[model samples]
Target: MATVILLRHGRTEANASGTLAGRTAGVHLDDLGRTQATRAGDRLAVVPLAELVSSPLERCKETARVVAARQARHDSVRPRVHSDKGLTECDYGEWQGRKLRELARSALWKTVQTNPSAATFPGGESLPQMQARAVDAVRRRDAAVGSAHGSDAVWLAVSHGDVIKSVIADALGMHLDLFQRIQVDPASISVIRYTDARPYVLATNSHEGDLSWLAPKHRRKRTRSRADQDAPVGGGAGPGTPA
Candidate 1:
């Protein structure tokens, strides 16, 4: 099992303006977004991350860089950043660059809110498909990291709000339609660990908190008990000692 620290990219100009900038080009984080990213990076600086992954989108890449820099400040084993398209923002298609207020008026908006599993953006992807891809991407990455760095490894993924929310919903074992109940704000951190039994979500949408405890602790050596040391050499009653 390896832990994934899933983070949403910092707010962009479109995000502040309440627009759906889905798949839009050249949408970088705004000034406040930069500050938010820095704060998020600070929160996670103490964690010994094995990898830093991001959506290829500019906002996510920028946020990932900030987190990587903060982590590298003290940790000598700085992780290289990797990009995955499956972690990209939801394809809003015609809704791209549209205001949320206006989009909320559309009939599809109700579907998105009330029954996301049935919501499909025109000329784009369905909500279910989006969730599937995002979840798959995370699982694939987690497996790869676990194999490479061992079960205790910690990794980071910088993605979009919807993408992270969908992944969290899956981790929580919630249905696609219920995923709308999960909120993922910009620069927020969420955590999920894939175990042999099931996925465990340790945190979600955390804006501020102490994450230093997540850093790997040195394993303490086991001390031998007095009885064990005195009673036996290699078991088998130890030369007629108490059976």
Candidate 2:
């Protein structure tokens, strides 16, 4: 299957102020956030993205546009940014637009930190609900990209910190309750490749690296073997090398 690059949106004024900007309109990337997004775009410029998907929220859309623009400069095909509400931030409901320091004082805050599966926002959705939709959206889009562009295809999804963490947790086969343990910093990159057997987490919470290695290589046409569906034993040779 195709590899999906999960990108958390750049920082915003709300982020710096420690506020939950959940589904809030007009919340955009701050100055540092724009710089962070630009750096991320520079890193991904070498990759030939098959598709670019983003949360409908403004912050994510802004980040996605930067990435798509970078791809346009190098690749003949200009990657189109597609919006997916499923990839949006968790509905914080009454909690939206509130300061994190205050929210942390709530009794439910403990539940959200330790037992997210059972914690539901006062007027919004549960963590489990958020994970369900996010994982579903990524898996569905991954399948479509693999079918359309082949197993070597690579794509991207720009979303919120919590939402991306949920998807990463699911890909790692970890329970949603443990998702908080996964840190998804602003504009950081995480990668997952879904196979028939299981999902392979290639990288996570990465802020810098040479991702040119991920660019699709030109090779002879051949059928995929069972090895392609499974991880090599004894930590076999890495990408672009003979196994």
Candidate 3:
């Protein structure tokens, strides 16, 4: 078992303007976004993260870099940013750069809002596929971290808002249609603990906290499995997989 810290990338110009950036390239964080990410990094600087995984999108990559830089300040080995396409922003297709207010008037908007499980973007992926990949990505990374670092390992996944919400829905055993109720804001922190029995949703959309308490406790001396002792300290193509 391990804890996966899901972080939404900071706000972008599209966010401030209420536009859907989707997977459009070159969308970087705004000034406020930078500040928000910096504060998030400072908040989690003391936590011992086993790995830093991020969406390949520029916004997520930038946020991951800031968090990793802060973690590097306290740890002997600097954390590396592992890109995962599975965590990328949902492909909004024709709505990639549309304003939300304008899109809200479209007939498809209602379906997206009320029944996301049945919604599919024109020329893009279906909602179910998006949720599937995002959930799988997080679960795969959680298992990898637990196997390599042990049950108490804490890791991070920097991704988009909808993707985080979908993963949160899965962790809570909620249906995809109801995932819309979970609002993930810019630079928010959501935590999920996966154990042998089930997943625990520790926190969601959290903007404030020391987070140092997430550090694994100092364990009493005990015999560890040979596999655990022989696990690689560090080595991987990336922390998570793509769809």
Candidate 4:
């Protein structure tokens, strides 16, 4: 088995503003978003990463660059950055630029909320379609990684919130309908250790801000290493959280 870490890109203007980015071009990371991504990179830098990859989208690319640099194996990991479109965010189609609340009021959006598993936005893809694409991207990447190297290789993949969640859900053998429970925040970390048998979650929602519950001590001290604090809990190398 291998280990895979799925990182969600940091927030964007569209994300902070609550707009549906939906495959928009040039929608780069905002200032706070960049800092957040950088901090996440700092957090991940201390860990040993075998490989790193990312979605082709600008946000994810930028985020991955920060993380790869932090890992100090940028050169080693750069060549592995496969620009897979399958990891792209959900295509909001015509509603790409619309606000979430505005879209929520639309009849189609309502349908989506009511039946996200089956609803498809006009001129866009459905949840199942997105899940399928995500599974393909994730599985193919892992298979390639396994084929290229032996077991014990740990890889990091930076992608969109929904994309990472879909991939994790697939790894868990959960239905697309269950994705709602898997919350991926900006620059959040989700881990799956692939063993000879199956993949398993090492951590999820490993982001800053409100993840204190995952590590109450990290929240209290705010200075102690998460690794020192949470290692006993997760039973892993350390708190795979971003430093």
Candidate 5:
């Protein structure tokens, strides 16, 4: 069996400033965010990190590097940082760089609430579309990383709140709406494991140094979607999906 560690990036200046930052430029980690990264890195540093992959977005990339560097894994395990467009935050389109609450108070919120799939983020991507892109990206990543490894692979993917939630939802056989229920704090660690193709949640939405459960009660009512997603919404440099 292979172990996979899913970690969310540290908080960023954009998060503190209340900006959408969808693929925006110059949105880097703030002081608190850096501390969050360092602490998260120290906590996971003990684990044997086989591979470290991050969202191409700066926040996640920076966080991944910090964690990989701190992990003392280079000796026992080879750790390198790689970027994946698939692992990026949701593209809020025209909504990028705007306060989510402000958007919720605006006219756009109605469209999003009513027809989430049809509602475009003005210039960004939809929720379902984001779910598709993130799911596909992770699947491809697991395949690539699993194939490239000679021994058992333990992979870590650092990503945005929403992206990670989507991945977790897919792993748990849930929907995008359930994403709202699964909370991913900044610098959190959510674990998903696979004995074969079937995946079970070992943990979800864990903050730095968290040993508690993020809840594992699998809902039996919802139907699991098997649709495959392969493309990215707005591609790269989008602001992370802040919960």
Candidate 6:
């Protein structure tokens, strides 16, 4: 199947202020967030993105536009950014817009930190529910892109930190409680490729490094082999090497 690059939206006032922005409206990226998004766009400029999907939230939309704009300067096709509600930030409900420090003091906070699978936001959804929707959205979109653009196609998804983390956790077969262990910094990029057998996490929370290797290359016709569904015995020559 096609590969998907998960991009967390850049920093925001809430992030700098240590608040939970959640699904709050009108929350946009701060100045540093814009620069961060721009840098991420620059890194991805060499790759041809088959699709650019983003949360409808302002911050994510802003970041997605920057990435799509960069692709426009290089690729003949200007990638259109599509909004997906499924990729939106978690519904923190009453916790929305609250300072993280204050929330940290609540008893539920302990449950959230230790057993997110059982934690539920007051008036909102559970961690499992959020993961279910997010994983479903990513898998559905990945399948669509693969069918439309072929296995070599690469795409992007700009979303919130928790949303991206949940997706990554699902890709790694990790339990929801362990998801908090994963760190998704602002504008960080993570890569995942799904196959009939399983999903491969190629990268995580990557802030720097040459991503041009992700650029899709034409594949020569060949018979399918076990390597197609399994990792190479030794890490396999790195990307760009022939099988």
- The most accurate candidate by TM-score is 2
In terms of lDDT, the poorest run of 10 residues in model 3 is 234-243
- Can you tell me which runs of candidate 5 are displaced by over 4 Å? 73-78, 110-119, 150-152, 208-243
lDDT by residue (191-223, candidate 3, tens digit) is 998876678787999999778777776453222
Global local distance difference test of model 6: 0.90
Give model 5's clash tally.
Answer: 11
Q: Can you give the lDDT of residue 204 in candidate 6?
A: 96
lDDT, candidate 5, 1-243, per-residue tens = 334688888888788777767788677888988998888887776665657889888888889888877865534554789888888888887788888778789876876655455556766788888989987877766666555552135578898887787789888887555566778988888886544437657677766454312211222222222311222356643213221
Query: On lDDT, who's better, 2 or 5?
Result: 2
Scored by lDDT, model 3 comes in at: 0.88
lDDT of each: 0.86, 0.91, 0.88, 0.72, 0.70, 0.90
Per-model TM-score versus the true fold: 0.88, 0.96, 0.89, 0.80, 0.77, 0.96
Model 3 CA deviation exceeding 4 Å by range: 219-243
- The predicted structure with the larger lDDT, 3 or 6, is 6
Q: Least accurate stretch of 10 residues (summed lDDT) in model 2?
A: 216-225
Residue-level lDDT of model 6, residues 1-243, one tens digit each, is: 789999999999989999999999899999999999999999999999989999999999999999999998877567999999899889888999899999999999999999999999998888899989999999999989887887778999999889999999999999999999999999999999887789999999999989999887665322234567688887777787864
- Model 1 lDDT per residue over 1-243, tens place: 578999999889999998899999999999999999999999999888888999999999999999888888967555688999999989988999899999999999999999999999998999899999999999998988877776667899999988898999988899988987898999999998777667877798899988876664433322223342242355544222331
Cα error, candidate 6, residue 68 (Å):
0.6
Question: Model 3 clash tally?
Answer: 0
TM-score rank, highest first? 2, 6, 3, 1, 4, 5
**lDDT winner, 4 or 6:** 6
Q: What is the lDDT of residue 229 in candidate 3?
A: 33
